[model samples]
Target: MDTKSLLIDTATTLFQQKGYKSVGLTEILKACNVTKGALYHHFPNGKEELLITCLHGLNEVITTDIKAIFSRHLSTKDAILSMIDKLILNFEKNDTIIGYTFSSIVSEMATMSEPVRIACSALYENIQNLYHEKLLTEGYSNESASAIALLLTASIEGAIMLCITQNSATPLKTIATLLPSILEVNK
Candidate 1:
């Protein structure tokens, strides 16, 4: 909508398709149809700042979706399954996933830039917190909920990485099938 938002959205998509290291400010500028002045005005620190902002924007959307999905499902397992199903459908339709791309960005930038690393860590923590809250609502103890949340996050992220690396969604689908039993959400 606005120039800043447009830049972030464009950068997010580009950085997802191409790693942050490979994508230049010029590509973002051209894609967003904005000049360097507009980008610098919104992101004074340059491309890294833009990457951080893009991560923030992406995390915001994910958090909102998690809330909405959790609210609608009424069961933690159902909510998680629905989220996984959505991921499967997205990959089946688009044949690409932003999570895989973001994983790449995190792996590459985690050692190079503190801000980028923090942004990725915060994004992960936010997702884990969302899952933790859901587990709490399902009557798990605080410790149990926290651990389950972390496990779920790691499993899903690992499945996505494996899916991308192996060029098959079977890993994700397998995890989706096994999650209900592994999570013991019904208990």
Candidate 2:
């Protein structure tokens, strides 16, 4: 990979594992075997700018992957189940789900950094909007669809954090079992 791509990839892994503030530019440079000048050449504004770039790239990845997963199933209920299943698969494969989630980073930065806050908020809103649209298409009223979408989004994110914190898939499994009932969908 090129220097810029290598730097981003390295930083992404570090950020995922240790968070944004914990990882320094020097660490990223060391991992990538690049000089500070190289990093500056690619990212003029430094770590924050690179993080923003990473966030944007992560948003694109999430949007595309989620749409692809949900598109295969015609029914909203099926699509949601598919998504939950995919989440389970992802969690099972990687003990630490990095790029797929950045809630920790958002919580740490939201109050302090306006740009990061806006980017995180926009990413969440887009996902919620997508869920709302799917629910509406499935015959739910607008208000009910939006409420349910928000509930599902909140629940899933919480489940991910809980699962990671506890180092077990129990939270995910429990949530999956309750989701159909919570959404009032017969499965």
Which candidate comes out best when scored by TM-score?
1
Error of 2 at 152 (Å): 1.3
**What digit string (tens of lDDT, one per residue) describes model 1 on residues 1-187?**
9999899888888888878889999889999888999999999999999999888887888899889989999888899899888887777777776543478788889999999999999999999999999888888889888888998999988877777778787878998889899678534
Model 2 misplaced regions, further than 4 Å? 185-187
lDDT of each: 0.86, 0.81
Clashing pairs in model 1? none
> Per-residue CA lDDT of candidate 2, range 26-45, in tens?
89999999999999999999
Worst 10 residues of 1 by lDDT: 92-101
- Candidate 2 has its poorest 10 consecutive residues by lDDT at 178-187
TM-score of each: 0.94, 0.92
User: Model 2 lDDT vs. the true structure?
Assistant: 0.81
Q: How big is the positional error of residue 52 in model 1, measured in Å on the Cα after superposition?
A: 0.7
Models, CA RMSD each: 1.6, 2.0
Instruction: Report model 2's TM-score to 2 decimal places.
Output: 0.92
